[model samples]
Target: MDEGAIEIRQLRFGWKPGECLLSIEAFTVGRGERVFLHGPSGSGKSSLLGLVGGVLLPQAGEVRVLGQAWGELPASRRDRFRGDHIGFLFQQFNLLPYLGLLDNVLLPVRYSRLRRQRCEEAPAIEAKRLLAALGLEGEALLSRPVAELSVGQQQRVAAARALLGRPELVVADEPTSALDEEAREAFLSLLMQRCRDSGAALLFVSHDRRLAEGFDREVALSALTAAPGGVQS
Candidate 1:
């Protein structure tokens, strides 16, 4: 049994007082499972990802990501735990413009000793290997400042950063929105292949249903969630 995946029991969350937005009876994602969760734009999908990635706390019940409940750890420990075991890819690409592509890819290692020690080949070697596998070339751009790279290049670098340390869980929210159909397909395939290679559980969130067909499993938020039961929007 892959008990290291996310397990939610009676999960409920909301912003304001007395307003419970996400209400889930139960949900589980097994290890190595590539899950494509789709929902409408305002359906609390990103919030769900936030909860799974330990960025948000539930008003009731519990959220367990990779066998550890987020609430079970102290706040500081939760931050470190997220840095060590989980890699999140936001649509923004979140790379520092001043840093080089190699440095941006190695950023996780600075905060995560486990990742640093595991990717021990002088760090840059691992970054290079990952970037190459991710279909990126040209050391000139790799060493240049991040602001100089194109959007696609930046996106690939973001992927390298997310997959660098072989995090147990990789959460991506609308990562392919900016790409065309061909690019989207290529990126999705690469992401799935990388997750399989590293044995990481992928939880990818997007509103586009057509792009989700290739994943190991598909989850629709409307099927598993109710907005606070009696609560209003």
Candidate 2:
């Protein structure tokens, strides 16, 4: 059987040693699962994404992705592991202002040999395909600098970048927060469909509870971390 996409146990994390931002006994996101993780602002949603993505490590306990524990890997290896297996959609939609949409989507291939190798076709071909799938088709649009795109279009570009190379896991940090209700729903639909096509598990973080529907499971950060048993698959 395939390993779970994410697994957490007795996890504790905080920027300062004594202050605890998150504490959970167990939490898991299974392979190919679409999990909506919601919580109020300042509830450690982004922090949790950082932990699972290996950008930050818990002070105690395990954060395992694809069955590999984050703490076990050295810093350099951790970076490589995350680059190869996890795709992140930051809240800011961090695209290079100067780079065109296609170039931005190909960024992962530049960083990760594994992801590059995973591309079934040429990297550029795959990037264009993802762009088209995300509703950013046409050379006029694809060739434009992402900086010129509107908020919604840039968000789609970011999603395409995250979905490129078909990483095993994708994490979105309030990706749809800027969109209106209709646009939010549309973006979510496209993002989820791309993840499904790639067989990548999605852990989408948001403060909006109304956006929770259609996910395979919806979990709240407070409940997951505060509950005695924590959340499990």
The candidate scoring highest on lDDT is 2
Residues forming the 10-long window of minimal summed lDDT in candidate 1: 224-233
Q: TM-score of each candidate?
A: 0.94, 0.95
**Across residues 1-233, which tens digit of lDDT does each residue of candidate 2 receive?**
57799999999888778667788888999999999998777777767878898989999888999999999999999999998999889777579987778888899989899999999999999988988899989989888878788888888888888888889999998888888888889999999999999999999888889989899999888887863332221
On the 0 to 100 scale, the lDDT of residue 213 in model 2 is 88
Q: List the residue pairs that clash in candidate 2.
A: none
lDDT of 1 by residue, 81-197 (tens): 999988888776569887878889999999999888778486789989989999987767667788877666777889889988888889888888888888888888998899899
Report RMSD (Å) for each prediction in the order shown. 2.0, 3.3
